[model samples]
Target: MAARREQDFHWAAVDRGELVVQQCRQCAKLRHPPLPRCAACGSLDWHEHPLSGLGRIISWVILTHPGGKDAVRRTGILVELDEGIRVVSNLVDQENAAIGARVRVEFGEPGPQRLALFRTLAETPA
Candidate 1:
């Protein structure tokens, strides 16, 4: 049997320790929340392209309420990747993530499954 390809490319990127996004081979357009076909050109030909793993914390929300059974206990962020793909994911390795802070992708077990979690990147002294 073929390997269980992830329905979401974000998960697939996590598996590879890299942040990636889908791009249409025909129109050369970038796409987020991966789909089976290109939304711009309606082409089936596409490929996964690695991102810079750099992004800004556009917006975030801390969930105080539980999501019921099987929900991973964590905070969420609506990060905008360097390539301009905005995706919602859990932020990790920080006491608190704030808006406009630099974040990078880190793979870890958010629940029973491994996933891509964003963390604050160290700032270099100027």
Candidate 2:
């Protein structure tokens, strides 16, 4: 999967312990989950820009199902970064989470793969 040219930029950054997204050179639009062309300007040329590692929890779900090897209770969270892009990652070391909570991105090396996770800076609920 790393051989895909479109995802190379994202995986390359994640491999180095950083979060990045595709930015269109023409319209200055940012695209995540990397695409072949910019949806805003239809430009195929783009670059990767590192994020601030700051975000806010917009929504989340905790899975309690059991699995084979890596089956553990995990919280899947949707973080809206300060840059206006939303990334889907897991909440590490958190038993519960709240919406609208402030969060920060953290890179984790779980097993042989590296992943981006979020931790709530403030678990404020309204």
Candidate 3:
């Protein structure tokens, strides 16, 4: 299946300001990076399971563009959600970006497209 068709549900959910994981309808197993079939049960049936939007940074890296004047630096992270599903997204604020740092997902500023980004829990106001 084409990538867009397989991930339409996920991107749509994100656009609605929610995060979701693909769950195997038959086995009830959860997976990210949506797929046409479940790896665990080999079932093509699945549903979008809304996530808590909570996770911890497991790893991260700094990406730097090579262009001189137009250079840009962004932090890319791998987050392991509370549900144990891992998601790859950009770090929004990039403060307190460390392994095991708790984070929450937030959508990027409104634009032509929105993205799932993360910020450290500590940075969030109580």
User: What is the C-alpha local distance difference test score of each model?
Assistant: 0.78, 0.83, 0.86
TM-score to native of every candidate shown:
0.80, 0.86, 0.86
- Runs of candidate 2 with Cα error greater than 4 angstroms are 1-3, 64-70, 122-126
Q: Which stretch of 10 consecutive residues in model 3 shows the poorest summed lDDT?
A: 64-73
What would the per-residue lDDT of candidate 3 be over residues 7-95, giving only the tens digit for each residue?
88998888899999899989999998889999998999998899999988999988766665324467899999989999998888776
Over 1-126, each residue of candidate 1 has an lDDT whose tens digit, in order, gives 766453566676678788788889999998887888888989989888888877888888766665554344567888888888898888895466788888888788856888878988775311
Once fitted onto the true fold, the runs of candidate 3 whose alpha carbons sit more than 4 angstroms away are: 1-4, 66-70, 123-126
Q: On a 0 to 1 TM-score scale, where does candidate 2 land against the true structure?
A: 0.86
Measured by C-alpha RMSD in angstroms, how accurate is candidate 2?
2.8
lDDT of 3 at 50: 92
> Worst ten-residue run, lDDT, model 2?
63-72
After superposition, the stretches of candidate 1 with alpha carbons farther than 4 Å from their true spots are 1-10, 66-73, 123-126
Strongest candidate by lDDT: 3
lDDT of 2 by residue, 1-126 (tens): 446678876777888888999899999998887899999989998988889988788889876655444455678888889999999989985665888888888888755778888887754644
